[model samples]
Target: MHLFSENLAVEIATYYRNVALGHSVVPKVFTLVNGSGSQYLFFIDDLQMERADEDQFLAYIVQEHDAVSYSRGTLVIVEKNQQYIEFAVVDEDDSEAIVCSAELTRDMDDKPIGLSEFEKILVKRESIVFGHLYDPVKLSEEKIEDFESLWEEMKPKILHRTMGV
Candidate 1:
């Protein structure tokens, strides 16, 4: 699919804003499929990092990776847990696998660091990218089921608050 970056950006922004406003626990990201395939990018949210553990962190990466793989597109997971969030890309084609991590560091002058430093860090994390292939069609269907389950779980809480039952 020929995914447009702008559309993806908008989706990511909207998702993030909703999450920030206490609308949902769903991760903020955009998923689009074009003629070529599908692509996703999780927006970095510094505030959400506090609740992130290594398992959740890794699972998030794997989830995105699987999403792209299933949709036959590319997935980019942006890590907002740290001062400098990193973007890690995963491709469906094994041969196209190129893992990189970049950190945004500020200099003494309060200016951003150069691309060279970013590239260096990206190169260093190449060995960490690992995950199984995920089918988007199946995942999409499963997500619907999950959402319904979530609604069911919240029904009691909502009723309790509204009716004092």
Candidate 2:
């Protein structure tokens, strides 16, 4: 509904530029929610549609996900069942990246854990962030459709960033 930050202005501009140039911008688009730390950050796009409210937004996503048979874009819903490693999630000059970790994590309750469990804490509050969400990954149409389930399968092989360089 709104730019995640003032920096997103450039991201929005780039989206338009790529659209104008007919580039495959899907990979570059990063839709997010200011879930306010109550929800797992997810990368979701509304296909650039406008909604009057949260109900409308979620409904649109569910409908479109089905109408296209979940074959259109990426969907990464963070879940606790998967293995996670610490990374420095950095925001720099209108861009974001997950970088090598210093090795530590904390849950939503702000509790230090033997291991990181971000999504789990958020999920315990609810199945998924109802009003907002966050996830960390990329996708293909086929993979996007079943992303939540296919995440582990693809995590090891995709993304230069995920390589833990």
Candidate 3:
């Protein structure tokens, strides 16, 4: 997973808050997603709606993150979800702290209300997608084998890119 340092997350949150307040876009929640599927969520103290734009906002995020090398993998944006309050693990010990106010529901049990309902719910939510790169690490033989099997099914296109393929 592409993990971000705590300092990095705080810096991003501060930047968005400053920009949003200055531009009168008062954003409620901020989120960042790295190419590796790691996510960061930030809750806004006071939110407004005028400053949300995918490209400009992402540009700011990339610049702040010094993520130019992995520009394709870093995404930054804000979200406004009414029902749920999203947050991040600030202190490793306090993973329940409210960091942001929006999140992705990965549980099948909490599936979206319905197509039409989902659309209405998403109207206030904004997102940005980007790419990021991370260092490679070695895995155990069993893990490698498992990854290979999963990759074969989920990312067959990557096979040809592997060394000695």
lDDT of each: 0.32, 0.28, 0.31
**How much is 92 displaced in model 2, in angstroms?**
21
lDDT of 3 by residue, 1-165 (tens): 123434334444444444333443333444444433344343322222233333333334434333311211111234323233222322212212213332222134433332111110111111312221122244567755654454344333221111110
* Model 2: per-residue Cα lDDT over 1-165, one tens digit each: 122332233333333334323532223123322223111122233223333333343334333332111111121224543323321222212223322211123346533233322221111212222322222223355644543443344335332111010
Ranked by TM-score, the better of candidates 1 and 2 is 1
As for candidate 2, its clashing pairs are: 40-134, 41-134, 41-135, 42-133, 42-134, 42-135
Q: Tell me the lDDT of candidate 3.
A: 0.31
- Candidate with the larger TM-score of 2 and 3: 3
- The candidate, 1 or 3, that scores higher on lDDT is 1
Residue 154 of model 1, lDDT score:
39
Worst 10 residues of 3 by lDDT: 116-125
Residue ranges of candidate 1 with Cα displaced over 4 Å: 1-38, 44-86, 101-105, 109-113, 117-130, 133-144, 147-165
Whichever of 1 and 2 has more lDDT, that candidate is 1
TM-score of predicted structure 2: 0.21
TM-score, one value per model? 0.32, 0.21, 0.23
Q: Write the per-residue lDDT of candidate 1 for residues 27-121, one digit (tens) a residue.
A: 32323222233442333242144433322443433354333331111223344322332233333333333232333333565444422222312
